[model samples]
Target: MNRRIRSIFWLMTICIIAINAFQGYWLWKTYQINRQQFASTVQSALFQSLEDQQVGDAKRLFIRKQKADSSSRMVIHRFDSMGSRHVRVFVNNRSDSISRIRIESEQPKRIVVTYDTQKRTTGANPLPADSIAKRISSLVLLDWTDRKRVNLAKLKAAYRSELIRRDIDATFQLDTLTSKPQNSLGNFVFYRNGDQLTTDDIIQTSPVPINPIQNLFVQATFAAPELYLLRQMGWLLGGSLLLLILTTGCFLFMLSTIMRQKKLSEVKSDFINNMTHELKTPIATVTAAVEALQNFGALNDPQRTQTYLAISQTNLQRLSDLVEKVLNLAVEEKRELVLHPEPVHLADVTNELITNHRLKATKPVIFDTSISQDAIVVVDRVHFGNALNNLIDNAIKYSRDKVTIQLSFRGNIDNWQLTVSDNGLGVPKAYQSAIFDRFFRVPTGNLHPVKGFGLGLAYVRQVVERHGGTITVQSEPGKGSEFTVHLIRRD
Candidate 1:
């Protein structure tokens, strides 16, 4: 039975460990999924923002060289020519960087037109339509040779303005669109998730005016907000953490239970060995006495025959008591021990127990008491006396020197705390907690001085508890031991 219980305990421990491992694996998988999903969602938002009409129109209008229909009214005021004038107009069309072209018009009369983006807004001071046209023409006269920094501030501002116009809430939306599209043909990057266009580039360039300028390799980096997955997969991540906590708790609980069961199994095995040792002496004595009366001439002499008979009877009774104690423990373990609680004076009970033990002891044993006010406690008188007898018996058996016993009743508001202390080869602190557990004993080495099944403390604990009380002990290896029973007082 002990082996089977140990096997079950180990199995339970392994199962708990496996469950924790599986949960950990699942949490890691969920993290990967969340990251993939965020990438997908952010990509989808970017594509949708690019397709926005306002964003598209803003790029188109920036490069619209006088609406296509108005191209028929050519000539920025008929060029005066000393001969037939050869005049050509060009617009600065480099979209990779800001226009830094040193605009120069050549025709024997040269004029340089330059503009700064920071000092003033382009359209704040309205210029003559033709004047604006000539300035733009001079910019393109250099054939878009401006390798200037692209001021993306205005374009990013326009992108957000459009997103707002489209009723796209950035809070709930991942459209962290901070860049303006340059060449309509900039290299594209795709993401694994989101609304659509999974095969799109991470850097998407909107349709800018078709220019003959070489497209410089541009890097468009898209970054999602921090802890985006933690926020987005809110419930999944939280549930994972909760699962881990529960798993850890179960693991610890199972580990503790398995350790306790293993200890209990060892203790119970030791109990059986001790019980066998205890029963062997009495059984051997009874058998020897019986042999002396029968096989020897002892029966022929009435005195000798009576002596053998008495020895056999005494040993047989001792054997009976040992077996009875074991059976009683079994009953207690099965929770089948019924109690008949009634009003009883704890002091009277203690005195009777001490007297019985003193008479039964093989050696002269001294008894002492510090009992206060014979307090009436509610308990089963018979079983309660039996419980105290176990304590006294243990006190006598484990005594290394002069055996001494003490009994006392310390009163609490609603209970009588009965204490049974003894001066004996005391218990070690390590084994103290297990002392009251069924079949547990402090390890006694080869000396094997005391002999009995380890059920006395267990029986005491059970009976005290059945009477709505508790039992505890305090002891040190060399000093002695004390058992305290807190039984409810009816008064």
Candidate 2:
């Protein structure tokens, strides 16, 4: 896939995975929290219920067994006091459940009783002695055979007796009394002077609820485990981001490398085509000149013979120059070329180059050397001479009528400048930048094109730069061109 699509795909995948992991962790934490809450609630309820049951049983034992006095004349009075104490203890300890205790003394003449309910103030008045005795007798006779019927009537009588004893004035009041299962403890309360007793069927509220602080602690403990998981997920996310950055960087590097290779391949192709044309032109010229010399009729005339010999020599030198330029370029490309620097007269070098190309010149050439006659530069003799010759030869080849070469020195003693200006067709402005590039030629559209591989100026530039120098061109369309070489003067 393309870079953008691939990046998006990985990003989406990472996001989805991260989201799922986070959600799963959250759900697991929530489940743990809920489970802890349920367990704590159940444990609290069981503990409260067990405590209430033990307290209720202890109160009943205190009333029925511990205070059962056998030899007391005021047995009823003592029993009544004991029952009130039992109720107080039951109320205090059994905070989670309802509890009550009643004690009745039976005598042939009178009946005495004391009762304590979990909740006081039943809103009633005291009952008569006969009615109170009857209620007590019914409770004492309670057994499995008629326990349900007797318990019901006993509770009703208790309510009437309590209302009469308390002397409650209200005409209408609620009576709430509840009976436990046959195997469980129950509580009873009377209202309206033992006229009625109300019983509740179910207890929905817990006697002792769970502590709020403990509940919060349990919740925090459950959440504590998730902290490490969250940290791990954060690390995973960070690693993914780093990986994404590295991958993007690698892709960009590969793309840049491919573009560079493509550009180099194009340059190599241009070099090959230009080299072939350059080599072929010199070979063709030499071959033609040799053929003219071999023809007996052309050699018969002294003038014609000399002309053919000179043409042959010129083409040979051109071929030799082409080979030398190629070899030098090869050495430079491999960074193996070395320069033999020596002091040389610039004027003598220029004159020798002119003499070498004199036969090949198609037009008359004029040399102007007005700046310095004894100008000496430390340079590689062979390469500098070749650079000067290449410029002069180009001027001669392109000029319509005459080629004018103006050589001058400029700058201070530390830095010297050698300038070669030619009055020939100027270089186009657009091609100036690439003119010295290997195998790059300006498109002149001349019907009879000048033979060149475009390597001459490139070679010249390489030589000048190697000598710690700079070369620049000044030209305008339809005007003459000037090439300037600046170098450090040898002390």
Candidate 3:
């Protein structure tokens, strides 16, 4: 797969695995914490119940101490043989009805109880205390020792505690304590002291039933939904980050590719331009030489032959110059061009190039030169002359009737400006920005076309830049173009 597809696949896979793992771990931790908290609450409630029972016992004992009665005694009961009993009695001096008592004992106890001036009895004669104790003992055995009844009571206590803890606001019509199934009317039976109590026996008491495990499950499930939501959100965030990175990478890659292509295009155009220039000048020189030879027999004279020979020699030299320029430009483009700078008078170089051009011109072209005799610059004479000649040739090719070539020196001794202006068709406004680009041509679509491969300005720019100078052009259509060269003057 491509890099983008592979990256996406791996990103999705990793996110899926990471999110799922994180959610699982988070949920498990929540569940464990919730379970521990629930267990803690249940234990607390059990201990609280025991404490409340102890407090109630203490309160009863204190009350009994305030009301002492000789005839009254406290009774204590123990449902299990292993349980203990305690008792205290209170007798009040001011009021007989104020008598109170407390008891703490393991076994059932009976006292001969009197209220104020009245003696209380449950049988024809006053029931013996020992007989009452025996009867209470039997009742306790029936309720507490019976396995089924003990289980039912335990279940009742546990269910009641759960309901209160859950704070269920509604009353349940069904039995709150029992594990038995209920009919539609919500009826059940319970055996207490060998007697059965039906639903009708305690219809007035309100019942609120709750399952503790179910409550825990509901709470966990409520938080459970958030797990999925968080996982999905994580996945979305991860995916978006991955997508952003991928998009940025792709954009950078495309930008790099475009820049490379543009550079290659410039190199290719430069090569084609240099190659055409290299070929055209030599071919033109050889063609001119052969044409002169064709006319040699018709003239049939030593002077004419010498003239033809000189023309051949000059054109041949032009071809040689063209070849050398191409080679130097190639080396420069590759960063291999070496400068051989020497002190040369600017006026002398200008005069030599002007003379060469005058001899080569088919039509009369005016030349103007103005410079201080002391004007000298440190530059590679050959390359500098080539650059100046390219500028002059471009001016002559585009001129209207006569070409005006002007050279002048201005600025301080350390800085010099060489201005070359021509009254020729100026560069168009639209093409001005790209005029120095290699092989860029202005399309006239005329029958008679200018002979050029469009490398002259590019060559001039390169040479000027190598000299630590800047070249700028100013022109308008149908007006003229002026090129200024700014360079450091040699001391």
- Candidate 2 lDDT, tens digit per residue, 311-371? 8788788889888877866777888447888878777887777677676666688877756
> TM-score ranking from best to worst?
1, 2, 3
Over 1-491, each residue of candidate 3 has an lDDT whose tens digit, in order, gives: 24554575567656666755675576557555644554344334433433334324444543354234234433332211112222222222222231222222211232222233343332122223443333333433333234231123444354346547764222222232433324667553333234443444311232212222111000101123234334535655566557656765665576567556665576576556555756676677777766876864725777777776777777788777767866765676788456687877888988888899899887678987778778888888998888899999988888787767777778654688999988788898888877787666665543224666567899888888887889998989887788999987544
Task: Give the TM-score of each candidate.
Answer: 0.62, 0.44, 0.43
Per-prediction CA RMSD (Å): 13.1, 21.9, 18.6
Residue-wise C-alpha lDDT for candidate 1, range 1-491, written one tens digit per residue: 56776687678778877887887788778778755654454444333433332223322332455555243222221122222122222233221212222212122123333343332222232223345435455444333345333334543554456545654323332222222234678644322132323324433333222112322222223434335545756797688778878877876787688778777677777877887888899989988988888888888999998888888889889998988877766675677778888778777888888778777689778888887554677778998898888988898888875888888777754756778898788898888888887777777674457776677788788788777788888997668899888766543
**Candidate 1, which segments miss by more than 4 Å at Cα?**
1-33, 36-226, 234-265, 488-491
Instruction: Please identify model 3 stretches exceeding 4 Å from their true place.
Output: 1-324, 340-344, 368-370, 444-448, 488-491
Candidate 2, 156: how far from true, in Å?
65
Best by lDDT: 1
TM-score of 1: 0.62
User: Model 2, stretches more than 4 Å misplaced?
Assistant: 1-324, 351-360, 444-448, 489-491
lDDT of 2: 0.55
Q: How many residue pairs clash in each candidate?
A: 7, 22, 17
